[model samples]
Target: MKQQTKQEILYRFPDGFWWGSATSATQIEGAANEGGKGPNIWDYWYEKEPNRFFNGVGPSVTSDFYHRYKEDIALMKEIGHNSFRLSISWSRLIPGGIGDVNPTAVQFYNNVINELLENEIEPFVTLFHFDMPLAMQELGGWESRDVVDAYARYAKICFELFGDRVKKWFTHNEPIVPVEGGYLYDFHYPNIIDFQRAVQVAYHTIIAHAKAVQVFKQMNIPDGKIGIILNLTPSYPRSSHPADVKAAHIADLFFNRSFLDPAVKGEYPQDLVDLLREYGYLPVTKEGDQKLIKENTVDILGINYYQPRRVKTKEHLPNPEAPFMPDRFFDYYAMPGRKMNPHRGWEIYEKGIYDILMNVKENYGNIECFISENGMGVEGEERFRDEDGMIHDDYRIEFIREHLKWVHKAIQEGANVKGYHVWTFMDNWSWTNAYKNRYGLVAVDLENNRKRTIKKSGYWFKTLVENNGF
Candidate 1:
C-alpha cells in the first residue's frame, strides 16, 4: 500500500483548537494522606480490600502530582499543551466533605492553579471525579438529597477559591460512571448490585449537577463556564429490525439520555421515567428539582467518547425477580469485523465521536462541547522501550488522529465542539483497575521513584497542537 501524506488528511479542525490532556486528583495526586487531605472513599476502600485493585495498586501510589505538579506543568508546556483539565479532590479541601477547609490542601491547589496560569496554560477544573469523601458516602452518597446540597456547598467553595484564575469549571466528570461503577457494576467503592439504588444514585447525581450550576451562576464569577462531563457511548442497532432498533433506543436511553437529557435538556427522557415507574425504581425528588434543572442547565458539555454500544434484541426473556435492569430490554452485541482496542477490550469506532457530536447538535441543542477524555490504554507499555528510553507509541498517535478526524468533521458540520483533551496527561492510578492500563503521552516509571519520560507520542502531539492540525 502507498503512503498518504499529511496534506492528504481528510479533516482539519479550526484554528485555536485546544489540544491538551486530562487527569483527576485521586488518579494522579498520591498525597492521599498528606497536606491535611482526609481519606476519600477510594482510600478507605483500598485499605479495606487491596486485593480488589489490579496489581494491588491503589490511589496512595499515584503519579504524586501533589509533589511534582511544577515539573508536570513544565512537561505540559514542553508538549505544547495550551490547556489542561484536572479535578479538585473535595475530600482534600474539606476533610469531612462538609466542614472546615484544609489550609494546606487549599494552598497546594492554589499553587498548582497559579503555576499553570503562569505557564500560560488554561486550567479546566472539574469539581468532582468519583472521589467522594468517605464521610459523605456514610451519609448515603448520591442517594441522599442532603448530599446534593453538601456537594453544592463544596462546589461553591471551589468556585470562591479558584474561579478567579480558572475560567473553565466543570461540575462532574462522567457522572454516570460512579452510578454504574458504584451502584450497579461493582467496580467502584461502596459497590452494590441493586438497580433501584442505581437509578436513585443517577437521579441524585443530576440534581447535584443542577444545584452546582445554580451555585456557579449565583457566584457571578467573570468569564466562568460551568459544565458536566459525560462519557457518551453512541448506541447502534444490529439491523433494521424494529426489535433491534428498540433495543438500541433503550440502550441509548439508559446510558446516554439518562444524564444527557437532564444536563442539557433539563428533563429525563419520558420513556426512562416510564420504565422506572413500571418497576417502582423512580428516585424521590423534591418539588423544585425540575425547575432547578430547567433553569440551571449546563453552560457547556464535556464529551468523553471512548467507545460505542452496539445493541440487538434481547437474547433471553427478562427476569421478573431482577430489580429493574436497563439491559433487560436489550442485549449488548459485539459487532464482528469491527476494530478493537485489544488492550482495553473496547471497540475502536472512530465515527462514534461524530455520532456523539451530532446527537448533541441535533438533540441536545448543540451545547458548547469538547472532547474531554479520549485515548487508548495499553498494558505493560514498558516493553516498547528502546535504548534512548523512548517508547514508540504510534498506536496511541493513530488512535488520537483518527478520533480527531471525526471531531474535526463534526465541527465543520456545525457541532459547536471547541477542543479535544485526551484521557490523561500521564499514566496514573485508576480506581480499581489501578495502573493496569496506561493511557498517557508521558510514561511514568514507577520503579524509578515515579520518574516521568515523554513517549514518542508526546513529541508527535506537541507538533499536532502547535500546528492546530495534523
Candidate 2:
C-alpha cells in the first residue's frame, strides 16, 4: 500500500503552527552606515575589497528594509505570516559590540518589532547571525573568552530590553559557517587558514551560545523559549560498504553533531572528542565550561535544511604536510542522476528533510523544532516575469511542494516538527554573491528604484498558509 491516506492528515499543520519566513539583519536591512549603525565585518570587508563580492555590489543598501520595514511587515500580514524570524546586528544594537546600547538602533528595532506585533505577527528574534562587529573581530572575534563574555552581556541586554514582547529567541544561526569560512575556507572576513584557530572559534561559539541561554533562563520571561538555529546537512554514504558508512559517520560528527549534540544533548559526541584529541586539535576549555553547556541545553531547536552531503571512503591519503580539513577522512561523492539546483550548485534531494527530522526524533529526544529555512535560489528570475509584472516561478513552487511532502511524511511518522519558514520573504543582498540569485516570493527590482512586486509563488504561499496545506 502507498499509505497515502494515512499521511494526508499530517499535511495540514496544527493550528498556530507558525507560518512565516526567516531573514537576517545584514541580508535585508540596508542603511548599513546610517541610523548610527557601526560597521560589521561585511561592511568592513566590502570596503577593503570591493572586487571580492559579486559584481562589486555590497550590503550598504539591501532592499532598504530599514526604511521600508512597515511596508514589508504589512506585506507579510497580507501573505498570512503569523510569525517571523529576524536577527539583531550586534554592531548596530551595541556599537562596538559592548558597553552602551545605541539609542537609535534601539528605536529602530522597537519600531520593527512593534510594527510586526501590530500586524498580528509574533516576532522571533535571533541574537547573532554572522555579522560580528569589526571591533569584536579586532578583539579576537569568537576565539577569545573576552568576546564570549561580551556576547553574554549583549544577550542579557537584549532580553531585558525586548523579552517582554518577543518570546522566541535564538542564540546563533548557522554557527559553523564562520568556522568553515573565516578560519578554514577563507570565504568570510579575517580569512585565515588555520585548523587550530578554527577549532577554537567553533568552541567559543558554543560557549557563547550557552552563555546566552543561561542568561535567558535567568530572566524568567513567561512562556519564553530559547534555542539555536543550525543548518543541519544530513550525511549519506555513497554505498553500503563499511568504509563508506564510517566515512559518512565522521562527516556527520564534524559537520552536524559538532553543534547539534552540544546544543540539544548538552555534550559533545564522544567520537568527535576522540578524533579531535587524537589530532591534538581539541579546543581549549575552562573549568565549569562542561557544566555550563550541560546545564543550558536549548528549550527548542531550529533546523535550516537546504541540502544533504554524500560522501565515501577517501580515494587517497591526505597529505600530512597540508593543513587539516574535514575531507581528510571522507571524499565527496557526486551521486549520479540526482537532482541539482544548477543556479546554486546544490543537490536537491527532498528526502533529506525527512531523514533529518527522523534523526532528530530518534536521536535528539524529539525536541520541539521547525523547518527554519528551506528555499530555492535561482538566477535570472526576472526572465520569468509575465505581462502583468508577476514572476511565474513554477519551478520554485514545485521545489517547495516536493520538500513539504517529505516534511508531511516525517510528521506522520512522529517527528516533533512544529512549523515551516522559508529562507526569505523578499529578494535581498546575499553576502558575497550580491544579487546573483533571487530566493524571494516578492521580487526586488534592484534597477527600478528598488521596486517590489509579488511573485507568483508569493500568492501561492498565502493560499498554502490559509489552507494549512497544498
Candidate maximizing lDDT: 2
Q: What TM-score, over all chains together, does every model reach?
A: 0.97, 0.98
The deviation in Å at residue 450 for candidate 2 is 1.1
lDDT of 2 by residue, 163-193 (tens): 9899999999999999999999899989999
In model 2, which runs have C-alpha deviations exceeding 4 angstroms? Answer: 1-10
Overall lDDT per candidate, in order of appearance: 0.90, 0.93
| Residue-by-residue lDDT tens digits, candidate 1, 1-470 | 13345676556668777779998999999989898888999999999999999989988859999999999999999999989999999999999999999999889999999999899899999999999999999999999887888999999999999889998999989988898889887899898989988988998898899989998999899988999999999999999999999999989888989988998888888998997788788887789889998998889999998999999999989888875567888999999999998999999999999989998899888899999999999998999999999998889999999888888888889999999999888998988888899999999999999999999889888878766787
The reply for model 1, stretches above 4 Å from the true place, is 1-11
Candidate 1: deviation at residue 63, Å? 0.5
Clashing pairs in 2: none
Residue 77, model 1: Cα distance from true site in angstroms:
0.5
Q: After superposition, how far is residue 44 of candidate 1 from its true place, in Å?
A: 0.8
